[model samples]
Target: MMMMMQQLQESPVQKNSLFNAMDRFIGAVNNMDQTVMVPSLLRDVPLDEDTEMSSLKSGSDDEESDMYSYYQLLKSIRVDIEWGVRRAAADERLQQQESHKTLSRRGSSASTSSYASSSMSLSEEEDSEDEDLQKQFQYHLTGLQGVLSKLTVQADSLTKRYKKEVGIGA
Candidate 1:
């Protein structure tokens, strides 16, 4: 037992901010699981009318999902986070070779209008794309922050709502 304690003490510290956030997220989700014992109670409870996450379940923009679905979604997200599963965005990591081929075709075309329409060099186009990529990074970061904020609120709301439904009255 002393050896085990010393081995544990010798382990490196987890000072990374991302890891800290993940730890908090996992703890909150665990709390939610404990609070929401009877998930059937959440079946028809509607989430915020904005329906952002529900839309993701279907192609339709105005899909109606109940609190139960949201609960499952949150749990699945927690699993993904815990397992370090990362998914790429729809527009992420465009093929640079394909882009270069397309750009080269545009620049080296026989039509004068094609050349006259845009006088930007290939390097300039690449630079422009790089700038756009930077903007996209910032945009995604902002969007992620918003989504995380909403999810946090949803998690707390679910826990509270579950408690109320279960007659715990928190």
Candidate 2:
């Protein structure tokens, strides 16, 4: 009974074995065993160790030297995750823009078709009603765009802060 309740409250990440793996990877990176950590890095982060080692080493390969490649690898993964988040936000924005364009086109075609057929059967009162409905839809679409724009701004700001914390520039 206690185990069932604990399972229910566990986070998705906590429930998955991947989270355990990530914790272990972080431990290995902090431990400074580049050989052990490098394999894990290649499997997960896929960085070029030669370049990363050069950056961290500043030019010596002394076994007990202060320099370690794992910190750079950890930092690189954090940067990559931050950039991935920004890319996902940008992709969402692009999708919203396309949807807005498609809706605008749809509304315009509907108005044009309605106007063209106005002479046949739709009464003046019905025309006014349709116009009101169209206005309401346009207003809703404008509100949606405003919300998305605000969200995008917030996402950008969050990403900037994350980069700054990770010692990376926007």
Among the numbered candidates, top lDDT falls to 1
lDDT of 1 by residue, 87-121 (tens): 55323434665788898878768555664487788
> At residue 105, what lDDT does model 2 achieve?
80
Candidate 2 TM-score over all chains jointly: 0.28
lDDT to native, each model: 0.69, 0.48
Candidate 2 lDDT by residue in tens digits, 37-144: 333322222122233233334433444223223344354544443345457777999999999999998987877776665554558768887999899988876664
Residue 68, model 1, lDDT: 85
TM-scores for every candidate against the unseen true structure? 0.58, 0.28
**In model 2, what lDDT does residue 35 have?**
32
Clashing residue pairs in candidate 2 (N, C-alpha, C atoms within 3 angstroms): none
Show model 2 residue runs off by greater than 4 Å. Answer: 1-122
